[model samples]
Target: MTPPAALTLEFVSKHNVEGDLWIIVDSSVYDISKFATIHPGGLSVLLNGDIAGQDATKAFYGLHRSEILRRPQYARLKIGELVGRDEQQQNVPPDAIGSTSSIPYAEPTWLAPGYRSPYYKDSHRQFQLAVRQFVEDVIFPDAQRHEEDGKPPSQHVFDEMGRLNIIAMRLGPGKHLQGRALMRGIVKPEEFDHFHELIIAQELGRIHARGYSDGLGGGTCIGLPPILNFGKPVLRDKIVPDVLAGKKFISLAVTEAFAGSDVAGLKCHAKRVKDGWVVTGTYARLPESPKDRSVYVPLFSVFAARTDAGGLVVLVIPRSDGVQTKLIKTSYSTAAGTAYVTFDEVHVPYENTLGSDNGGLQVILSNFNHERWGLTCGAVSAQRTILEECLKWATQREVFGKPLASQAVVRSKLAQMIARVETSQNWLESITFQMVHMNYKEQASKLAGQIAFLKMFTSRNAQDTARDAVQLFGGRGITRSGMGKFIEHYHRTLLIDAVGGGAEDVLGDLGVRQALRMMPKNVRL
Candidate 1:
């Protein structure tokens, strides 16, 4: 309740002995006298003459991340301010929470100051700011905590997302959002477009926790769109309102044990029965399927299965007597709720069919362009974050008594990282513009291959960027914490982009196949 005392440098200088020590970081003074004995680096590291009673801002930053100071115990060590606002930390409380980065190439050029964009209007920019603030205040902290503990996102996050109607917005522009007050009316429903949704994905990706990012309504973003576009009115009314409200969960159950991305190769079968169908199949690695049985009871999912005569169909199946789920531990954190799901003779209502029984391929393909495009946006944003981190590390970190950026090799890696992310971002934005301008059918016919190629390019480049970032950071890059924590995590999880929605090789082949279909009949070659 009381203000911290204001102290001057001279008075703090005398208390430099073992029993008493003082240091200034970003102009705020910390009395690490008692803490010195218990400091993680040990008393000797804190007792150095240059740090014990001096302005150690640069030295501290060189060795530790700023977040270390934000921890309760370390923050409690701050006994007073250093008596000058101009010299104080730029991130002082109440003002420092969610400001955009000053680092060049940290954010998309459109988000950078003194930069202009043709795609984002005032509303999109405003919406992006609002979402970034929420993600910083809420999602990011939880992301770090859960990513380590391997737990799903907190319920408060789900409730907060629902309060903002973020779940529906992530599904992108649709009739489902007609009456909703999105972002507290920051943008009207009709005014909402794919770019707005892109902003949400990119902003959320800044959390730097890939597994946690997917857990935060990953299912709703990729799965619910099918229901919105194809489910019958009665089915839509029954399912849409509740799921959008964040009261329920749904995941796209397409990948199986045998069929990863080859949609036509899925062997899950549905036998015709009275009033509904009997589904028996396994849906593997469903992103964030509700695994908590007591709270959510039955997992609600929309999956693709083969009907009689070997025709693939898409249907909604609720958790029931024949349903089962087993968590699939992965290299990434378990916060994503990645599971291997089995449905043995599960009964789904006839009205639950997403589209015509045999049109599963079409039903699935209709959403693929949007899903793949969203993946590109997320991948570009994520890769860009890594680039910013690498840039910061290279600039601040000292190697051989000079800034790491001074090294010719480090600079070259940085250049390569920058080029990959910037090119991917440009391609992603161009495709986004097409999505905004074209109709759904037109998009499927014309933009499918383009989206596939864009995803392939973005994902492969992300792999390269991750490699360069790790190489630049060296040992620290591989370490899970400290200067290269994000770089390490990114290197470990970057594969999801290349393989999740579709494998890079498959996507590249599909793009070529699409091009082949549109080739001129009278080609000389």
Candidate 2:
């Protein structure tokens, strides 16, 4: 490295109208012209010479300096150290630059009866308002005491969430609530970015900042869909209603220490008994805050195991005498509680077997399509929050006699963040629209690829946005106090991308497999 460059700029000062000019900053060259119009931040940085170049170094310091060099666009560069270089004096990658052309936004138009006004409109808005008021009046105050003691938010807060019908958003109409898992696809599609589903994702993201958002949306995915889709009518009638009524909270506990993405490899096992089944396994818990001391006992555990018939099965086991829970400390505290569960010969009645004896794999697969999508929503929302936070900090934070937002470099960073969010959001919504209305059952092969693609993109985007938000916050971002808690939540939640439904690599492989299925027989993988 040559004493580290002061700054580097890559862009054509003058070029043919159709040509792209690559500009090199630090060790990497960026195809500024190609990025010009396509830049989500805007065209200003691209059109203006060296926006992120040498002269921009005044705003540079810690991670930003290293981050700029790590952009995928610069991976092929051979240079080291910036050492204050002029625009015309650097090397630009030849093929890296492309022709100047317009890039179209990928969002699709939302169509009718499905695109009806939001479910949270009119009376629903009042409900949301009342719920928020409750959070402020009762929950927030109680949460403060827990916060002071370094404990997770109070259980009263969660109970309040249940009382507000937040937990019942999917079951049926409660307090005039009519949104179902299916209808939510419609209402959420309208709110999503060009990607369509990203909008509903944002809503979940907001609720997540406060406390346990998993049981609500996550339950709707794995919990309701499975039993409703596969369980016997008696099981549906007996279990589904309470799950919908907020009387019970459902969570899928398939991920184990050794089997993260390998669902089929889960070690949990069940043995057949005269009446039903005996299940035994250890399920890991994320962690809990110690102050409030209100224990969260997981009443429902979705256990994946190989049945005596030599086929995979999912047993829905409710907490009973045989089931035991142990609290575990974890990285995130917003989630009031998490526990390691042990089922020592826990007996689940035959009626509780969610799907056919050997068809548990299908149930698990079906549940993922929606669960991954919910994560997509949360991930995108995380980006949206990062954007808002960055803008606020830029405009409000003063440095060296001027607000940080006044600097061209800072503005450029902000713009890049905005562009990234928009692009990801658009992709999210598009996939959501396809999922909600496209009837994937008839085209399982075709739908699989799209879902996997969206999952991978959205999760990565959320992680990236969280990282950027922390950077924008600087020292305050790393702290556990004040607004820092939000940043901490975002930081710890990175696992959400990889854990929830499937790993990024797993999704990518499934996407490729789906794409392969669409190919002609001769070319199939």
Candidate 3:
């Protein structure tokens, strides 16, 4: 952790040969003689006379991100710094991991310097910084590792999250946060409004691993809320604490093979029993239905089934006898815990029923509103990240001896990316403000259509942004690693936002139907 030694440029330049190659990047001296051999770009690129120890700062940054230098193995290569200067790395703030980006339009307007907003107060701002730090220190490494290995997130990460009560916070403003200190008391539990929760969602999307973002606790966010609101006291009291503490996992099981958006069409059924209910159903095991089912074995499932009366009944079915699950390799990383689940005569206690016996539709519909809003926050965050990446790359990357930004078409693409993300962020924030003032029932009635439309708009914009990003990043955008890794991941995981919570087309229809329901009977334009 000590500051590196200081070295003169004269001395650094002397070691430019193959056996003693050196480079100066952002006033830091790195001896790459040994590292060059194993460098992903190969030794030839580093050996070029112009770059060999001759302040390769420009060249180094041209093809790579600042994070690559932050890796321990690479960071340790900094034996010293330039003799008479401060250490200033490109694109890295002094407290880079937690600090806000200085890039124009890189962050939400409220986060930009000198920009102010009525929606976010001091508590919200401090909470945003703290959450971003927590995500970088606690979540980023795990996301990067598990995203590639296709493994579920590490338990230690979840343990840390639990220690910080982050798992509970992800569920948003509620009674669950009453006693727990949030972000080291930056914000009080009662004062923690929807904006605070919005910050958490936005910070999480910065992880850039959609699957891990969900895998982190996606199930709990959508699934537990239903039980907490409607389940019997006994059931809620027992399941709420454990899942919030990260001791267990839960996923919404409302979707089925036959029913993607049409919940009424699910074939899953539950027969009345002596003590509880005997539930049986076969899921198409599609991506949306049972996501995260097999991530952590023995997780609780909140699903619906048709009753003897032909009405839908919602229940919490614990994974036990006759419950089976199979993993499905998805287009994105398996860290999402994508799987097909089957409930063959699974028993559900009567106490586990949520809401009225035949009112299952309302439970799932309510859960969808929150899920859609969260997804919109994340979708906007992802688009902003792509915009930042493209901006940096366009400025530094040379095309035909001039910066790529010089190209008219590239600038046009960048402009579109900017407009789309900003519109989404602005709309998302406006909706979030409404959520803050409205009660749950009010939100259910007034904001559901607005939220549905907002999510549809944000996600659809995300697709266009992703495409523009691919066009801007070019081959590197499609490449799975290095410079375009995030772009590739975002482009690949379109299903999570666009299709998971609710398909775009279906949500669009829902928004329209809700609007039609509210139309004035006798009003004229």
Q: Report the number of the highest-lDDT candidate.
A: 1
Better of 1 and 3 by TM-score: 1
Span of 10 residues, lowest total lDDT, candidate 3:
284-293
Candidates 2 and 3: which is better by TM-score? 3
Give the number of the best model, judged by TM-score: 1
Give the true-structure RMSD of model 2: 16.5
Q: Residue-wise lDDT of candidate 2 within 333-452, one digit each (tens)?
A: 335356777879888898888778888888888777666666666676666655665675665567787887888878777777777767766676556555545564743645667777
Compose the digit string of candidate 3's lDDT tens values, residues 241-274: 8787777778777768888888888779999898
Q: Give each model a TM-score.
A: 0.94, 0.65, 0.93
lDDT of candidates 1 onward, in order: 0.84, 0.56, 0.83
Against the true structure, candidate 3 reaches a TM-score of 0.93
Give candidates' CA RMSD values in order: 2.7, 16.5, 3.1
